[model samples]
Target: MDILYTIGAVLIFAPFIAFLLVVLIARKKMKYQSIGLAADLTTFLLFFSVPVSIKAIWEIDITALVYLIAILIAIVLLVIEWRQTKEIEILRYIRQTWRMYFVLLALAYSSIWAVGIVLSLLHFFRI
Candidate 1:
């Protein structure tokens, strides 16, 4: 239980670190794609597990379900991207425009973490 929160908390930073690494050091390489993908998955799992822990200790919030669905969507997108293994039309275009993909994921994941921080603080202070 406590460990779940700890892992979840730690995982919350994974995506940010990955994003920063990609933007700062690996911006010129295709490796950013794998790093971003790993970060996104970590972010998804963090949210997914946190909600489960919260539910075990307290009543489940509506927002938990929303987060679960969002994680599922993220996972689906990752799978769709992964299944482009052969790099056909759309996949080839996506691979070619990897920068665009990284930018969008960065924006989305950063905003998610930002909102989570705000909401956590609000809840902590009972504001």
Candidate 2:
């Protein structure tokens, strides 16, 4: 059970690691976006599976905390960009460029927490 939680936490945090690697190594826009997309999608599925298997939930788990932190980081990023630009231009640019990734990440990120909560509700469920 603890191993499952640790593995899930690692998967959830893997996107941040991928982001750093892409920035430091690839330095290619496409590569960075690809890594982000792949990580979010993979972690989304990985988190989705464990709860389904255990038929239970773990309360106050690291995976849920990681998801929360991810959401907060995203909110901070958007706020910083908006504050810096002080216009709709950045939004328009994101809409034109990384909109799909942004949308998917948002959905997947939210879903991870929801799943965690529901899985946590079941008695004796150790995710």
Candidate 3:
């Protein structure tokens, strides 16, 4: 059970871990980016599966806070990407690739957090 919990945690955070590795450490290496994206997709699946995996898991209720935050962040990233696309010609090399990866990362993170919140609620209710 402890090992299962540990593995669940890892699955939940895999995207963030991969993103950090690819962005900070790998420095845009194509191979690394591909691996990171794959991990991120897995993270998405794990996130969606949380309720099924944990018998006590329940749906989260968050009004629109998460959506609002995600919209704000997406807008900010879009602006930055737009500026970079205009100013740095070489940015074209990474623009589409980076944008795709960024969107995937954001989605994976948000989904997992939502799932975690639901799981927390389930635990609280002892369901």
Q: Quick one: how many clashes does candidate 1 have?
A: 0
Model 2, 27-115: lDDT tens per residue?
45565466555544554454444344323333334556545655666566677777877764665545433444445554655566676
Across 1-127, the per-residue lDDT of candidate 1 in tens digits comes to 9999775565554545544554556546656565665544544544444444444335565555655555565556656766866454666444434444445545655565576777789899999
Off by over 4 Å in 1: 1-13, 19-92
lDDT string for model 3 (1-127, tens) is 9999886666554545544544564445665566555554554544334333333333454425434554666566667867766654445534544455456546645666687788789889999
TM-score of each: 0.36, 0.30, 0.33
Whole-structure CA lDDT of model 3? 0.54
Displacement of residue 83 (Cα, Å) in model 2 is 1.7
Candidate 1: residue 8 lDDT (0-100):
53
lDDT of 2: 0.53
lDDT of the candidates, in the order given: 0.54, 0.53, 0.54
Q: Locate the minimum summed-lDDT window of 10 residues in model 1.
A: 48-57
Local error of candidate 2 at 120, Å?
A: 28
Clashing pairs in 2: 56-125, 57-119
**Top candidate, metric TM-score:** 1
